[model samples]
Every structure is written in C-alpha cells, then in structure tokens.
Target: MPILEDLKEYVERATGLRRPGKRKVSDLARARKPHAVRFKDDGLVPNHPRWPLIIYRGAFEFDERHDPAAVIEDLFEANGWGDTWRDGIYDYVHYHSRIHEVLGIARGKGRVRFGGKKGRIFTLKAGDVAVLPAGTGHQCLSADDDFLVVGAYPPAGTYDECTTIEDRPRALMPIPKVPPPRKDPVYGTSGPLSKLWKKAK
Candidate 1:
C-alpha cells in the first residue's frame, strides 16, 4: 500500500502544475524520424536502430501526498540508474533508438503510440507489461488518473542524454525518409541497425 500511495503522490505532484491546452498533431505533416543518442566510430548518428535495450521491472504503489519525482529518482537509483526530469508531462512523443524499454504499470491507465504512423496506439493498465522496441517513436496519451511506469534501458548509459522536446502539443513530427538498407554479398551484416534486423529476422 505504501508503494501505491507513494506512486499516487508522485503523479499528483507531477500533474499539479498548470495543464497546458491540448495541441493535436497537424494534418499536414513533414518527415522527421525519431532519434536517440548513440556512440559510433564516426560520431553519433541520429537515425540508427539500437535494439534489445533491456530493463528490469519493479513493484510500485501510489500515494496522494507523496513526492512522485523523488520516488521516481529513488526507484531509478535502487535499480542502478539515474533519473533526469524533463518537461513534466505524462504523455510525450519521443524515441530512444539505442535502447529497448520495458514498462511496468503500477496503477491507473494510459496509452503509448509507437512509430511515426498515426492511429497505432498501445494501451497500458495495472499489472500490464509492454516491451518497446528501439528506434520506434512513442508518446503517452490520456493519463486519466495517476499512473506509474518503470522503464528499463539497455547498453548502459544510453539514457544518460535523453532529449526532451517541448513546445509541440499533441502533434507528432513526420518520419523522415531514409535510404533503404543495403543488400549484397559485399556489404555483409554490420553496425547496430544490421544487428537488430538480423535478430528480428
């Protein structure tokens, strides 16, 4: 009960701030692929796939009067990770290409949209487990009540530099068009994206 209370407290605190008017994604969209921080031999590439970003799920509870931010920080530390606060909105349109994430919902309900394509959404509820593949664009939608989610990332420190986007409300940027993957005997499977395709294939 304490865990749940604590989680509830956090959500309340996070939502206490002024609720900005909802901004829907524009009908006319341009191409803009999601990007995550990556370390490469030739600097960081914004549009590469990094897969298998694993995370350990943990138990949590909610507290109406508890500090959600502090509780989240504590949870991350206990699990050997650090917490960084960006603009405080439960729902967001962002993607981490280098890491896969596991989300454990402790309380309440919410929805997550993966990929740049609209109309595709994943919903979450108490005791539900969702695995988010890397390089996929996602955003949380409709946090009706307080909800707690534990996310796990792979490749260590991949989340150290998470980019938070602000000023765009309820609108998704278009996915950028990129060159197709190479197919030939000369260009054998290599690099992060190639590895992900091989594993998924």
Candidate 2:
C-alpha cells in the first residue's frame, strides 16, 4: 500500500478507536514499547518561545517483526508535523532558525549535543525521540554505524540553518508567529506540551 493509504488507515484507527479520554499514541506505544518523556528548561539558547525540548524514551521499540522508524514517522505526520526525512545526524553544528524540529532515533545509538557549544548532551538510541525548539543548535558528537533518525517539523515549517548569534535577530521574529500543532506529536491534545507551549511568549 502507498504511504498515504497507510497513513489514512493509521489516522482512522487512531482517532476512531480512541476512548473518551486517552492518548492514542501513548496507548499504542504502551502496547509495544514503554514510552516516556522529559522536559528541559531554558538553556544557553534564548527565545521567548513557548515549547521545551521534549525527549521521549523508548518511543518506538522495534522488533524484527515491527519497524519502529516507519511507525514513528507515521505518528508524526498524523499529528500535523510534516517535511519528514530519514538520515544520520549532521556532524557539523547547525540549528534551524525558522521552525522547531522533532527527531526520532530509529536505529542504533548516538550522543547529540543541543543548544550550541554551551548546551547539553544526550544519548539517543532506537525508540528515542527529541523535539527541538527553533534556534537551538545541535550536532552529532558520535554515533554507532546503524544510527538513523526520522525528523520532521510542524505543518509548513519551512526552515533555515543558523550556526551563530548572527542569525538571532532575523530568527527570533518568526518564533512567536509559529503556532503549536493542535496535538502533541508524541502525545495527543492533552499533553504537557499543549499547556507549556501556550504559555510561551
């Protein structure tokens, strides 16, 4: 089946099969892998933006019988995130100044640094997911041979690359204009991000 067709079914099954009050994505993941999340505070990077860098652990535990990357990608798309792609993390330092980003670690493991050189570092493996707010820099410190990431942005999240503060003034203006997705990419409408992001300046 085509990806769109599969996406259609995924959306229907997810929305149609939901209970009155439950996160379908979380419930779905619970049936496969144990899913978890973490929220970060304002780091070296500065923005009045309302979202945090979300990390979802065991977001897509894959088995020989199940493809986690594909599942993660689908979930993201169904949640109004788009511009999906798959690749290893870029070795050089870079950040998207125009839009936020989400990265799903589909296979293998790696160390990634976020928020420029002064930022924090994280270890990501298969089933891990990281949601990066705009203007935060990141780079792959190291990785295993099979490391793969599925990345995306919210609907129409056209992006640009920035390596330093030179991009800040131009970058900051759009931050407030970027609206949050109706549903959290990993969780659903009632997720923490829904509340935190609304509080963003």
lDDT of each: 0.38, 0.66
TM-score of each: 0.41, 0.74
- The global Cα lDDT (0 to 1) of model 2 is 0.66
- Point out the worst 10-residue segment of candidate 1 by lDDT: 20-29
Worst 10 residues of 2 by lDDT: 30-39
**Native-vs-model 1 lDDT?**
0.38
The residue pairs that clash in candidate 2, if any, are 50-200
Q: Which stretches of candidate 2 lie over 4 Å from their true place?
A: 1-27, 31-50
Candidate 1 lDDT over 4-50, as tens digits, reads: 65554466447743211112111111222212222211112222243
Candidate with top TM-score is 2
